[model samples]
Target: MLAQTALAGATSFRPLRFSDDGTFQISIFKDLHFGKSKDLVSYNNDRNSITVLNTILNAESPDLVVLNGDLITGENGFLENATVYIDQIIGPLVDRGLTWASMYGNHDHQYNLSAEALLEREQSYANARTQRMVSGHDAGVSNYYLPVYGSDGSSDPKLLLWFFDSRGGNYFRELDKSGNIVPQPNWYNKTIPLLAFVHIPTNASLAAQTVVGIDANSKPGINNNVPLAQQGQGWCEDGTNSNDCAYGGQDIPFIKALVKTPGVLGVFSGHDHGNTWCYKWDSELQLPGVGGGNGLNLCFGQHSGYGGYGSWIRGSRQLLLSEEALGRGELDTWIRLESGDVVGSVSLNGTYGEDLYPATPNDMTHS
Candidate 1:
């Protein structure tokens, strides 16, 4: 088992565990894009985003909530007001007495706003479980893990949750003085079932969408409108060519690590606002060096905020992990919209991609 490090100076944290019924549910709100401005339009959009959060929280009552990224648009943020957006975005979760973890998005790094400032603000709340596990490290502030114990009250954890900081934004603080961007080491044992969350999707995710073709009718999700913007936008793997269609490939190492790791059920990401579908990474479409899809599934969280670009009705992705299901290497997930409708429900198991789901509810027509 990996060493469980408590947040420095943290007073108390709500322990995460399955219920008596052996189930733990998580709701993921991605790309909230709050605090663009204090204008009436931006204010209303932020308000609507909060409403979506509240609606889904009341509906799913998930054991943990994940603010996947882009909690604020840092370009419009000033030093005096940048971190305040974190307070507003987390208000809904705190009001419901919910615990949450946050990941920093590409838009979150700016002159005034940063992952450090944002994490500090989030950690100020007693209910916020966001942690900087490796202090004084440049791996970004949100890199940490949480253990979910079994319902029977044993000390051993039945499930492990991993969070990564797909550091983005204008600032390049993640790089060390040597200019090397350190990759996170494989830290968990293969025995426990693990789930990972990040803000920006990796190259594997983009490759999956490209190969599968993002169509709601065929893929079992809503709003396949925009193309996925990966972690590194320009520059190819060779690190020479700019404007290469092959992508920056900086995230290749991360993707390779995940694909090779065992017990990784699925990787959940939030960045492509218009795309929200889960695709089993096909071995045939694996990138240049990354081998074996290994039954790892790639999923996008619903765009839960009104501040972002997309017009899709706001919603959050819900995940239900049961002890019995974990024994069978299976997971259940879906999108819970603000309208109180459930869509894109499916099981992530051996036969995941082949499984049929209820037709995605009409999202474009509603909003």
Candidate 2:
């Protein structure tokens, strides 16, 4: 069931419940941005990322590993950079037989590659079938959703995972092409158990329209329905990187529409690295952590660019959720370093989850 509330100077989110009957383990991270610029990919960072990734693969041996987005940097617009990064840097793991899943980020598509060029890049991968692209879709469409069912392929299923290609699954596409962003719903929504992944945060709830809660400053910017920034979320600092979406503009609307559909156990996202607290999104306020430190049936995700691999942002909540934990009405969602050490973890706050507002005439709503 869902819950809600609102306040004068506060922004809230709807909470969710994840099933506790299955043993599902997952590893999620984003913004590796390999091949972006020589300066960005120093040996130290690369080696650090490699160490952390290797540790995660060994320690958790999770049923699944999800690289949220921005796996490679395509600044100069070379599809080969993406290819080389994954193939040489990460593809080695594929040969070692590690089951992993990935999503496309804005950087990957920002390169402005032609469809033919993209096809060639896809061809480089042996399991290209597993990867789905949203290049040649009609207007207002990016990529379709892919359902992930547990660890066992031909046996019992454990969890239902939904991977959305936000940013239209590519960076800014040509006008004729659907811009960078995806999560297309051509046919009706399918009925499947799901924990969704989007690249951005929605936005401050509609009620926040009049209220500027907690250090909230009104910056000048245009926001996309997803996490992309149209103008800019807030004011930029002197000489700051203003090229990216400052906030998850339309994330709020997307969540409301998705949750209303049912079968959406929870939604996990990356994009916002600074704010990483587990809170219950409701009509009143967003409560941090699980309901009583003993909640279950739901969880949210995030953490991008840890300054280095094997590390998490300061003030971020670390978690570890497993099937056994969920069965006990506990999701082993833990926060840890890239080195695979459990730094600090949050207990599930099983408060009933709900969307604070649905289609309210505000920024995050009615996108």
lDDT string, candidate 2, 89-155, tens digits: 3443454444445665545555343323443543444433225544445321223344434333434
Q: What lDDT is reached at residue 221 by model 1? A: 80
Q: Can you give the lDDT of residue 212 in candidate 1?
A: 52
Tell me the whole-model lDDT of each prediction, alpha carbons only. Answer: 0.75, 0.40
Candidate 1, clashing residue pairs? 106-168, 106-169
Best by TM-score: 1
lDDT, residue 71, candidate 2: 60
